[model samples]
Target chain A: MSIPAIASTRNDALASLLDNAINNKTKPLGSLGMLETVAKQIGLIQNTRVIALEKPAILVFAADHGVVAEGVSAYPQDVTWQMVENFLARGAAINVFAQQNGCALHIIDAGVNHDFGPRTGLTDRKLAHGTHNFAQQPAMSSDTCATALAAGMALVAELDGNVVGFGEMGIGNTTAAAALMHKLTGIPVAQCVGAGTGLSADGISHKQRVIEAAVALHASATEPLDVLATFGGLEIAMMVGAMLKAAERRMVLLIDGFIVTSALLVAARLQPAILDYCVFAHCSDESGHKKMLDNLGARPLLQLNLRLGEGTGCALALPLLHAAVNFLNQMATFESAQVSEKSE
Target chain B: MSIPAIASTRNDALASLLDNAINNKTKPLGSLGMLETVAKQIGLIQNTRVIALEKPAILVFAADHGVVAEGVSAYPQDVTWQMVENFLARGAAINVFAQQNGCALHIIDAGVNHDFGPRTGLTDRKLAHGTHNFAQQPAMSSDTCATALAAGMALVAELDGNVVGFGEMGIGNTTAAAALMHKLTGIPVAQCVGAGTGLSADGISHKQRVIEAAVALHASATEPLDVLATFGGLEIAMMVGAMLKAAERRMVLLIDGFIVTSALLVAARLQPAILDYCVFAHCSDESGHKKMLDNLGARPLLQLNLRLGEGTGCALALPLLHAAVNFLNQMATFESAQVSEKSE
Candidate 1:
């Protein structure tokens, strides 16, 4: 399968208009700082001087990765399914943040091992229940990778908002994300690996070795999807597909953490245009996230050291998106407020 | 009048409980990142594991400084009264952000040169129609400084919230804040001066020169109050008073921008315990703000490069305060979610 076409480019005319509009707002010019940047980016993306985030939603993909068997994660593989249930029950940190920020949440089971079976708010689009252990074999076939990507794209197409945040929950997926980062960026696996789910120093080194061995096995994989099929989790593939679709639909894609960004790296390689639609939510303390963000030249909204991958960063940044839009629309201009501008 | 004593120390016992509670959240340990730090700080401040921000108010003090006559700021001093009027009309950035975050805003006429007679939502606490020309003479008499401090203390006493944010509006007050920062932190005047209200490079140098000249004039002023009386704007003096009162009452104080922190430096000096009650809201783009934050060993929640300085930073951060408190109070524990904890 080929990468989907993304044709939208940022509207420079609207961006300049936003700049003038933001500067004329009763405050000092450029005093809104990063908010002015946010306002401009959104205005340019939507191609409008009048911008607002309407019906924002968080799309969270949950799956299992084959690498958990290598003892790369501190939590057991079953915890993935258990946490998905927790998300369904609205009892996780993501749920609390989503509720706090008024963001609608849709959790997807891309390829978790357990059968959730017709749960509300859960999109069951499992890709072969779980991928093949990439340590011994390709994580999934090229066809399965395409299916996962299409599933993600389809899931996003069903969402109601023009702005959406992406997150994922899968034990050992960080190992997959790290491996993908290493393969794509060629940053060593040691720097890419981190203490996912609270691994100790020794555990991290061991996880590093597992990822390194897996990378060696997949030496023949060179294409983006081939690499994804080699080392990516099912959820990551879907997210890569969903991100492209979201960008195609011109939705604001809120990208979260290391796993989400690894998928984003795949999506970016597939279609560099997708970067225009993305807003990094935070810099996770998770290893390699900073490097990934640096590689993309993206500045995230928050830096809260959050490594929880269940779309929590997306939920946290929802209000900030609201502020950016609302400030652009609602803030009184100098003329409107009859306030004096700075004198020369 | 004497400086009010602030007796509140961070509650260590409750902090330990909060640490345990936060660590046991369904998310991985330390995964919540800055949110966990925020939760711990609030829990310690309130001396309770269960915390809530009730009746959060942004106390915005607006006054004029005599320093504007020296051409030390980018905007004319009349803009101070104009902005206060804008605040009352809900046409300012502070008003928009305050409304967005549901923070009750109390705009004070600390010493604006204009008479905004009998306005609702405007607290009339004039401090002698702004300060004297500090470049030529002491900005305020010691007697006026005492009255300003007492008024700020009285105003906080009348307010209904246990959580409050401090903000100020005064043209040329950045010069005053820079001068105050120079005096308190002993940093050079040039480093503390910046493009306040859109000053050009020449303007900043001129402002720096004006500040240096004033600091030289007040070389004999040694005590904090003496320094405040010598160089502080009425709003700064009042904020110092209000901050001390807020700390004495054990209310959480959200400190904003350069001018507000300059006032807080005075307050903290008067009573070191006041630092225990304060939360740095954002690192303002104002030149001296980072130094001021560093002087206090504070880590501000946001770094949006905002320099608008009307408690706007406080308002932007109000939702985050809510997130921190609500997440602590509302997120299901690992036990409640029945999710397995990270195995040792």
Candidate 2:
């Protein structure tokens, strides 16, 4: 299947109007800081001065990673499906945050090893029962990877929202993400590796060695899609597809932490303009996330030192999006309020 | 008038229980970062494992500063009452953010130079028409300063919320804040002074000179209340009182930008224990705010470069407070979710 097209959201005509509207709001020039930038970006994306974030949703894709057999993760592989159950029961951090921020959350079982047959609140889009162990071979066949990508795109097409936040839940996926980051960015494998779900210092060292070896083993897989098939998890690949489709439809893509960003790295490689539609939610406390964000030239909105990523960052940051849009739409102009402008 | 006493929120017995409850919440230990810290702080403040932030509110205090005559700010003094009118009309940045975040907003006319005369949504708490210009003399008499503090405490007492966010609107308040910061923290006047509401390089230099002279004039007033009487705006003095009373009542105090932090510096000095109930909302984009926060050893929840102080930072940050509480109360435990913890 062909990747969806994402147009750059840069309209010089609309940019001037958005800037004028934002500047005239009873605030000192640029006093709202990053929020003003966000407002302008949202306006540009919508091609209008009046922007509204309607029916926001977070899509959390869950799967398992064969790399857990290499002892790269601190948690057992079973936790992936178990957490999917927790999400379905609305007892996870993401569920609580999504509910608090008035976001509709959809949990997708992309390729978990356990069978959670026909569960409510769990969308089944399994590409396979997890990818192959990359320590020994490619994580997934190229055909399976393509199918996962297509599945992700199809899933997003069914959702109704102008904004979509991408999150993931897969035991050992961080190892898969780190490997992808190392191969795609050409950053050192050690720099890409970090403690996944609580690793010891020695465990991180070992995980680094595993990713370095895998990256070296797949040296011929230099293309983004090729590298993704070699190292990316099912959830990560699916997210790449969802992100592309969302941007194709001109929806604001709220990007979460490390693993989710790794998916974005692959998606962005295919469609660099996809960056125009992305809103990085936060820089996670997880090691390498800052570097990953820097590699993408992304400046996230929040830096809360969060690392437990079930889209908690996205949910926490949804209000800032609402605040930005509301300020642009609702705040009185200096002319309207009769507030004095800065002294000449 | 006597300042209200604020007790330390330290409860070692309850701290252990809160920590235990937080650690078991179906995620890696301490992965929630600042949210975990905030949750623990709120739990300790409420003295319960079950925490709820009830009826959150943002109180915006507006007053005119006499220091504006010194040309230390970029806007005219009339903007204070104009912004107050903007707030009453629900057409300000604070109004938009507060409404979006489900925060009840209260606009208190602490002492604007213009007569608002019992506006519908504005509280009548004017200490005077405006403050005496601190560049020439003490901003207010000691008696007036004391009355402002008492009025702030009284105002908070009439409110129903268990949380209060303090914001200010005064053309020359940043000058007042700088003077207070320099005197209290012994930070140099040059370091404390900044571009308030968009001052030029020469305007900031002039501001620095003006504040240096005023600090020298008020050098004899070493006590916190005395310094406040000498350098504080009526709105700032009122905020100092409100913060102290809110802490005394065990309510969470959401502290905003430079002006708000100046009020906090005075309140914290009067009752050092007030720090326990306070949450630094954001480190503003204004120069010296990070230094001021550093002096207080505060790690703010957001760093969006926001400098517009109408409690917009507080309104933006209220959702994080809600997220923290919701995660602590709603997330499933590892045992309950049947998810495996870190492997041995």
Candidate 3:
């Protein structure tokens, strides 16, 4: 099975019209800064000057990584299930922000070790107990990787929104993201690894060693899916699938922090058009986020030194999108408002 | 008349309580980043953990600086009154952002060179037609400066709110802010001046020379008020007054860009306690804004390279405050949520 094609390229034919729509607004040209860019991007994506972010939702995929047994995470692997429960109960930061920003949230259990039988809120799509420890062997088989991706695609296809955001929760996912980054970008593992949740200097060094060992073990994992199967979490694979499907549907995609961005890196590599539907939410304080962002040439909306990965950044940014959309839709043009323009 | 003493000190007594309140939230300690800082600051300012931002308002002071006659600005000085009209008509960027953020904006004719008698939406607080060209003589009389400050104080004193934001409109006020920054902080005029509205490199250099000339002519003006009388716009003086009074009333102040921060620099000098009430809304893309922020030790909430100075930054930041407030008031603690704490 293969990832779905992202067929919607930005409507460059409407570029001139969009510029006039933005510039003719009763303000100095480029005064709105990044907001103008957002308005224009959304307009181009939807192929209409009148852009609406409808039925916005944040899909948080939760799975555990077997590398937690190596003590790579600040929290134990059990916290993955615990955070999912917290999300369902509307107690996490992402939950509060999502509620505040009027975003519907869905928690998907891609491959958590725990078995929550028919939980009301969780979408149970467990691929297995968890991915195998990549430090010792491939994290998932290629078949398992494809299944996880398909789970993500299926989840997004069922969602009722043109604007979607992706976030993830896993105990040792950042370590996996780091290894993936190192392999994909050929950035050093030490540079890619960061103090996720919170790690001491020694622990980070130890993590680097573990990842270096893993990379050496999987030297032939050159293909994106092969690399993902070797080191990526099931949740990451699902997010990769979800992002592709969202783009294929011509929906606006909000990409969250380092872990999610790493997934995007894989997804973008597979189908480069996926990024055209995407807006980076914020630059994470995670050590390698800047490098990943730099490599992608993505300028995020906010940089609050946030390292929380529960789609909190996406929730925080939803209002900016609203503001941008509302301004474009509602603000009177100079001609309409009868405001005098600058004598050029 | 002297600047009113800012009587309210930060509630140090509640610092520990605020910390405990923040730490006890279900999220990890310091995970919220700037949101945690905002919550703590608001909590301390109100002297209560039950902090609420009531009746949020953005006071946009519109004035004209005589230095615009020297070609110190890219736009003609008439743009000040024109933009004020735009604000009233709800056609400007500030108006759009303010409306989007649920901020009740008050446009004050602090000293714009316009005679619009009894405009419905505008607050009539005209000090004079405009300030005197400080390049030729002092900008305003000492008595005028006193009255301007008093007017700012009176505006807030009459208004009913514990949270206020400030924005200003003037074509050459960036010149005034740069001059004030140079004089007050001993930073060079060349370093302080930036493209006001939209100036070419030659235009910026000319602005620098004009400011340097003014500074050389008024070398003896050391006191804050004297400095205001020598070189400040009426809007700047009024903002200085308003900020002091806002702090005195223990209201949370959302300070805007370079012009507002320059006014804040003056207010902070007159009474350093005023700094405690201000949350630098965004770091402006202007040349000297970073220096002003550094001098004040302010870490702004947003940095989208925004240089438009009509309290647009303040309007953008209001939602973050709401998010922070909502999270603190609404999120479940680890104990209440029955989530396990980190084992470290």
Candidate 1 C-alpha lDDT tens digits along A1-344: 45679866667677778889998888998898888888888887787888878888988898898878787889888889999999989888888989988989988899999988898888888876777788899999989999989888888888888899998999999999998999888888989989887899999999999988988888999888899999999999999999999898888889989999999999998898888888888899997899989998899888878899898989888778888888888878889878887789
Better of 2 and 3 by DockQ: 2
Give each prediction's DockQ, rounded to 2 decimals. Answer: 0.78, 0.89, 0.60
Which candidate would rank higher by DockQ, 1 or 2?
Answer: 2
What TM-score does candidate 2 reach? Answer: 0.99
Better of 2 and 3 by TM-score: 2
- Chain A TM per candidate, in order of listing: 0.98, 0.99, 0.98
Q: What are the runs in model 1 whose C-alpha is more than 4 Å off?
A: none
- Ranking, lDDT, top scorer first: 2, 3, 1
Collision pairs in model 1: none
Pairwise lDDT winner, candidates 2 and 3: 2
Q: Of the candidates shown, which would achieve the greatest TM-score relative to the real structure?
A: 2
How many residue pairs clash in all the candidates, one count each? 0, 0, 0
**TM-score, per-candidate, Cα-based:** 0.98, 0.99, 0.97
Real interface contacts reproduced by model 3, as a fraction = 0.52
Q: lDDT tens string, model 2, A1-344?
A: 89998899999999999999999999999999999999999987888888999999999999998988998888888889889989998899999999998999999989999988887788988878898999899999999999999999999998888999999999998899988888888898888888878999999999998888887787899999999999999999999999999999999999999999999999999999999999999999889999999999999999998998989899989999999999999999999999888876
CA lDDT of each prediction against the hidden true structure: 0.88, 0.92, 0.88
Model 2 misplaced stretches (Cα beyond 4 Å): none
